[model samples]
Target: MSPSFRPRAPRPGPVKTQEELDEMVRRMKGEQKAPDNYRERSLKLHGWICAKCGREFDLANLHLLTVHHKDGNHNYNPPDGSNWENLCVYCHDDEHSRSILADYLRGDNRKK
Candidate 1:
């Protein structure tokens, strides 16, 4: 070891108050596994059928179907589910790939 090289002392971060810690825990619990109302509504509105592949889903394989945002804006949910479609996981991946391909053709190299 070089005598000139000294190890730096460990620094402590700013401590949160007990109230802040409690609030952080509460927020984490609320957001960690919250369900989306739009997904639930879309399922009820459109049923468990893939719009692209026309595959039907029931409670046995309901997880295979997913709600897709038509305009690619997930936050732009409509009450009528007009911007939402039920798609199988495979079709959803293909849909996103097509979107990416379109963007690439237009010289937009951003990855989604």
Candidate 2:
């Protein structure tokens, strides 16, 4: 390398084109993965109930809800869907908060 050679500076302009935006979105979509049926069973445990408030929901409303793991481990999936539980939105929120808090206390849960 020549000592006199200098590296170029980076450009500072913002992205402005639809193609640029679409490319960015496409890159982000690559990182997402859909959950499987074992994961789907948690919604059934809620039994038309909202985890957040224990209110019974109609079929349509419950359909919009989701089953979640109390732990952050997506790999802790239960077999035969027996580990499933139904919880309305509110309860789900509380469960997540509690799980984080517990992990913090135990010192096993660190931000990855």
Candidate 3:
């Protein structure tokens, strides 16, 4: 190895306290970068309607609403909102109760 190639420092370990862990989870739950400006663009393109039931709504409903990916890829959140489909409060709750949501998103019931 060359003397100029120094090793990088190891990162700090995971949070020890419940509070710290919760904070980290909350931050990661939503993509905080750029304040989700792209989401607004999607809502506009889609007429801010719940794609499943054809229900119409405004952006403020976002507080109680969500955009779900049918194929389930958070990383593939539709930059143009094509991959996004609006979900109302009821539908959102129902979808998450299914195995697809539980297994992929929550990783619950996973074998240890």
Candidate 4:
């Protein structure tokens, strides 16, 4: 004869009050660090022009400008802005596509 299987019930955790929940949320918010503003820093260092195409930009079209990491590492931002270049959307797309094509041709399918 086979024994019937039964699952164990979940253990109940201590319930937090509304004030406790709010305090926990407040503590989490306080512990969070401000996001890196590397784009603005790169723009300031490299100027408002595309590095590849030399396309100029103004306040109106500044949104189209993007910061490209030279080493392709987003987390490798330096305060000196050594690894960043300002590129327009078109040039940035071309730059990434070229790299992808190169990797494909070299049979290197690893994500960077």
List the RMSD of every prediction in angstroms: 6.3, 8.8, 14.0, 4.3
What stretches of model 1 exceed 4 Å from their correct place?
1-36
Query: Candidate 3: what lDDT?
Result: 0.69
2 versus 3: better lDDT goes to: 3
Q: Candidate 4: global Cα-lDDT?
A: 0.96
Model 1: lDDT of residue 103: 89
Best candidate (score: lDDT): 4
lDDT of 1 by residue, 19-109 (tens): 9999999998988865558988999999989999999998999988999999889889889899999999999999999988988999999
- In the range 1-112, model 3's lDDT, one tens digit per residue, is 5677778987888647998888889888775665555456656677667767777776566665567776777667666677777677777777767755567677576663
| Per-residue lDDT over 8-107 for candidate 2, one digit per residue giving the tens place of the 0 to 100 score | 8878898569998998899889877855766346554446665566677776676656676555566777665444566666777778778779889999
CA lDDT, candidate 1, residue 17: 100
Q: Give stretches of model 2 more than 4 Å off.
A: 1-35, 38-46, 51-53, 70-72, 75-79, 105-109
Greater TM-score among 2 and 4 belongs to 4
Local error of candidate 1 at residue 71 (angstroms): 1.2
Each candidate: what lDDT?
A: 0.91, 0.67, 0.69, 0.96
| Candidate order by decreasing TM-score | 4, 1, 3, 2
